[model samples]
Target: MRTLAATAAALTALLTVLAGTTGTAAAAGPTPLAPADLTGSVAVTGISLSWRQPAGGPAVASFRVYEGGAVVRRTATTSAPMQYLGVNTTHTYTVTAVSSNGVESPPSAPFTGTTWTLGMAPQCDEPAPLTVFDVTSSALSVRWSVGRASPQLALTVNGRDYGIVPGTSLRVGGLTPDTAYTIALRRANCDPRTAPVGYATTRTLPGATNATAAPRNLATTARTDRSVGLTWPAPSDGSYVHQYAVYDGAYRVATTWTPSATVTGLFHGTVHRFTVAALDVAGNESEHSPVLSLSTAACPVLPPSPSRVTATAVTASTLRLDWTLESTAGSYTVLDGDSAVATVTDPGAVLTGLAPASPHSLRVVGSLPGCPDTPASAPLTVTTLPGPTDRPVAPLGFRVAQPTVVNTYDADVPLSWTPLPGLAYRLYDGATVVGTYPGNAVTLRTRGAERHQYRLTAVNANGDESPPTAPVDVITPFLVAP
Candidate 1:
């Protein structure tokens, strides 16, 4: 009887274990369907993954997202925002659906997605070209095609990057005038190779400062037949004056940095009204100053001086004086000492009857009708050639005059003689030849209270000397102050 009881207890324990196994097996739920139509889009910060709801399966309670082989996210909606993803990195994603009973479905085909950095480029259509217009000294206006608008797009100007607000056009300010700028359209997360670039220059604006006052005290400083010199006090505000403009009547004749200018190329003997104005660097000009009326002196005014005088073609009894004239309307007078030796209308003249080897002082004066002679030109001293030796003659009228005081301790004896044309005269002190001259007069220097004897001879062109003239004696006296 005890053995029978033991078999029954073992059978009951077996049945209890079978029933518990069957109950646990019944608690397991049905499999769900995989997500379908998986797709993704990239943004500057992250990527957005989306899928269509799976159909014809156990009721889906949620979705699971797998990156590579690891599960990364779980969501109840059809879209997933993968935030804080790595930039420029490819992420392999697959979606699976979970049932209400906690049963899971097989993952759908892998759907690859990528996230972009701030400057990372995406594989997409390029945006339209940017349009730039309304450029000014400190600002500019820009616009672009409407279809090209994107949150990741930005405008770069002169190395400064700017964000695009919600608008079709943008105005950039704080620019500089007359400066070149590089303008580019870039996507925040775009490839550098595809960034659209352009160039533009800003326009310069007129300055605000204007020269307020006219030049003061405009007056003529000098006047000539063809030119007038003018001067003025710089404008009280000199900083506004870039230059001074001088005007004759309505015509601008000169521009100068100082307060003075010369107006030239005017008609002689005519009256003119002159004025001055100040010009600023921005090209703004002040009002003209008070008028200055002046008349040029009449014609025959001292002609311009002659220049470049030269003695050429010298001979025993003649020489030619060549000079340059500033004007051709006047005649030239050749002078010896204070006397007029010859007159010529041309620039050249010849003086004849000059003693041989005689030094002569010559000058030229320009004369015009009804006008005083021009000042004599600078003197040109020249000597004539001696006569032929075969016909040499002694100087005549050789005499010595009374002594005259040369300085406090020196006296000069005046010697005079008749000069022969084309002959040089030699003066002697006692037996020694003291000096030679081509002229008729000479002075001998002597100490006070001295006695001197003088004689004269003539020299020919061939260097032959004539017989000496009779000797003349003179006694120099020292003067005593009373």
Candidate 2:
């Protein structure tokens, strides 16, 4: 019985010790979960790996990524990107999680990635074909096709690097004139050895020279009121002429590519002097050619003076002047007692601000473009009608005459009203005045089958017009064949 008690006590003590050890171990460090869903991708120069955070485990303090048994990266996040790897190479990666207590979990499933070759670099696949043109004395144009959108390229000219440019072409300027240059192109961030090589050399052009020969045979070809035209022969010297500069007097009027040019904005009947000089492409101008003197044509003559001038007093202070012109006139001027009373474009004008019952001398003149004032026509002498002491009585017996005949193209109708001595009558067809006459009768012609309404008014010396006569509607029949 003593030996059994001793063995039982030892067993109890051993169980207590084992339990204490287990508790201590659990407190010191927590087991972290393994990373899940490992994924990787290959880039031009490196590989990138990612994984999902393990669930149902102690919070991870950091992550570790491995590549083929080698620790490639360590981070506190679930992603790892490694670079500067061999091109066209394949790699394997795995991820693990570490707990805050410094305990590590098992690694994630292996993921493989392959680094891209230089040919797979962005915008480097099937590089653009190169071209060189616009060879000049101091500039060259280099162009290439961009196989991809937004391509960036690097260019080198005579050992000078023009850091990465965005477009597929570039113009190299400020170069030595009449000299050769070596040009090269490549893709951005690509190894010189791996990128396709393209090179060219510029050809030299002839050096520029001054233009020393003036244009010859300069003469006036045409002249007008507002412009003068000139023509000249090209310079005989070997230098190329890019343009010709024409001068009117001391002012440079125009520059033209051809030998002929017109200097505009000149005055009629004005004399102008012109000279021309030849200019080269290099901005060198030759001496001026011989001075050419030319004169614009004289101002045009005015239309003939208005004829058959007649003046009649419409009121005590107003006189109506009428005239006829041989041709159309641009404008007309009416003069009373040496002063311009009215200016009109038509042949007739009304003169106002005159004395009542007084004699006035009136004249009319016609004008045209470029001719401001024409000579005054023959004077017309007339006495204004005397002002009436009282309103005149209305005329009586207004009627249309008989025998309204239809001509080949028009109808002729005669109209008459009771005569009022010393008074003028105005005849109207609708609202338009057909005629003004001292007599009481008038005739009118109109198109066939057209209706005509006639009315008459009597005007006194004081410009007072009586009420219109009764209207008479007249329609003429169409002309019959004879």
Candidate 3:
């Protein structure tokens, strides 16, 4: 007998060939059957039911299958030698035959089939052909050529399998938005699962905080009414950064690979400060750099206040004064006895045209271009014509270390000076002698009206007092020993 192969569909084509009637060729009448001559029982997945049967002939039209007290049908022919006695509703199943003349035969025997049992779980197996095909920012699709192997094969995830659903593809949702997740696949088909076979890991999408390396060298330049052009190195500096964030203080200005950013809607003729930060793939942001400052072209703003104004008695007609220079100081003025004696555009203030041996009161004032003038320094009494004789000679080999932070005038600040074999040395607080050290270093308590002044003078064997030297403001007392 010839068996015809069917179409491309697996189950449809397979069943089409097996669904034919018995004795299509030259077989004779139906043969006699006995339970003792029956073949062994067979089982298959997805089949509603299965059975064993004895051989017979073409005269038999079908078989009567029995379960519990009711009757079910298979092929409806005794000679077909094949029947699908599906055990859908009953506990035990048995099969008998029916002839073309409608004669019913005795029940064949009963056997127990597969069903759900309490505490009886399916066998667990590794996923077959579990392969990842496509990966995206938030998901990865994997294909596994895995199916049920037993009467009831369950699909397992992580460790346990969920039974019933017969679909192949399953979506792994609720995964981390932008992180790696370890997935372990499992298939349960036994009473007790041994272990899951398939294991895989994949990364997910990323948010803004999940940056690795941030931007670098973010600076602003070129100005219009309200627009400013900002230039940066790159988003991913040599691939160190996964992305970048351009921020205007607290808010993000832009996010992308664009190296240059144009910021508008700024106040005209006003200067603004901006900053840039970088991020890497691991979500680590680098430290922020120094603030880059830029401004629009406007009239010069008021200058900052001046500090630490020092006056040196130059002469009666001329007094030279120095001050710590800052960009904000527009001009310096020398006031004598509440009157502006000299006003100079230069940072230093010089006062001239004064009477000799006169007790003149002087004050230094700092003023900006448009801002109000501020008088900070107190009235200083500067006398003139103490003459070139007051000039002092510095002791030989003078070296001292001043404290930048903790300065105590009484503290012993170490000093190294050239050894003067015969000349006696004296330390002066301005014109007055403050101390005399037998050696190069001497401990002197800095004392004065405004600040401590220090100078060194040497005496020859003739007992002549050398002129006084320039003094320094010892704000920190830690430098007292000299």
Candidate 4:
């Protein structure tokens, strides 16, 4: 009985200890569930893996992806993309869920995937068989071929990448003149370990020189007061010439890429000496061509004043004037008093439309192209005869326009009036008739510094006169007639 009691007590104590151990585990927290539905998608050199979250367990904070029993990625999302793997290879992966308290659950089932084969993956073939041609002082052309059809190749000039080239041939410019350069072509978008497929070395042609590339037949084509045109034959080595420089005596006046050029802004009636030289792409100048002489057109001069002016009455309303000049005159104008009457090309001009039986004062002036009219000749006086008996009505609206300047030696007062047909107008200076004119407007030449009262009247061919206009006062500038 004593041994049985001791055994019962020991069994009870063992049961209590077991119950306490179970309660402690329940208080700690729930265990995280492992990820489920693990799967993978394959690519050329990579695998993308994904899994579902546990449906019944403590919330997961993160997921860990395992590859070949090693943790390759730890992510909070359900998917992960793996890269940089060997082509035509296989990979296996697994995933586990992590609790908020940093506890890890059991891993999900392993998944296997295979990358694309070497033939199935994208490929870049290297360019081969390089050829160089048409090399010049500042540029060169290159071409190449490939054993198989492929994407365009990238070009390397002097170890610098120039991006992908679209065609098999390329012409490169903006290079140093007369220089050697290294060129290479390689497959584009390929592994960095791949080597270039084609390489070539070429040197540009030598630069041109004045002694070797001087232009021939440098001749002047045209000349003007402000400009000159010149043209020349291309040099023997024309392929090397890039431009031409024109020099005025010793100064460089112009530069052109063609064989001809124009020099501008020259002085009128002046002689000029010009020369031209050839320049290469390297800015090397050749010896200048033979000097060419040219002369611009002469500057214009004012026409000389007329001399020996004479007037003669031809009819009651017509007169003839003649004059001579030293230089060639383009035309001559006859002036009655200070008003221009008519213009003629020859030395003599017929002055028509004159008042009958009226005294007149006339002079001649010459004009030339591109010059001002010459000064008037000394005045000549003449009188016309009377006509049939007929009287004209009185003129109206007579007035004067101020500020009239005739010439350095004379003062002209401009006057106007309403005109009548078949009649002539006459101006009076204080009852003394100054001059008679055919038109309603007249310019009266006055002398001496004095205010004069003037009146106007209309006269017929019969020497008859109408009532005079109200007198107008005119203050003349002090001048002496010559």
The segments of candidate 3 whose C-alpha lies over 4 angstroms from its true place after superposition are 1-281, 284-305, 386-482
Task: Give the C-alpha lDDT of model 2.
Answer: 0.61
Model 2 stretches with alpha carbons more than 4 Å out = 1-209, 300-482
lDDT (Cα, tens digit) per residue for candidate 2, span 217-327: 898888875578899977566657788777653345789999999876444454555767776676444656666777776552322455556565555444566665533
Q: Which candidate is the best by lDDT?
A: 4
Model 1, which residues run further than 4 Å from truth? 1-245, 249-307, 313-315, 325-329, 353-359, 368-372, 388-482
On residues 1-482, what C-alpha lDDT tens digit does candidate 1 reach at each position?
22354344433422110101111333367888787656565553356776654346676655778896776765544557675453345678898876656577888877665544333343434553456665544445555432212445566778786644322335554454566776766655666566463334345343333435767788888887656888888756545678876655434568899988877644345456566767667444565566677866555243545556777424455465766543333467888888987665546665544555567777878774455666677777776554432435567899877778765445788889988788888776643558879889988777554555566778666444665666576666444423
Lowest lDDT sum, 10 consecutive residues, model 4, at: 14-23
lDDT of 1 at 158: 80
lDDT of 3 by residue, 224-283 (tens): 644578887764435565555454422344554556777653433444445555545643
In candidate 3, how many Å is residue 217 off?
22
Q: Which run of 10 residues does model 1 get worst, by summed lDDT?
A: 14-23
> What TM-score, over all chains together, does every model reach?
0.26, 0.26, 0.23, 0.23
Give model 4's TM-score versus the native structure.
0.23
Clashing pairs in 4: 210-286, 210-287
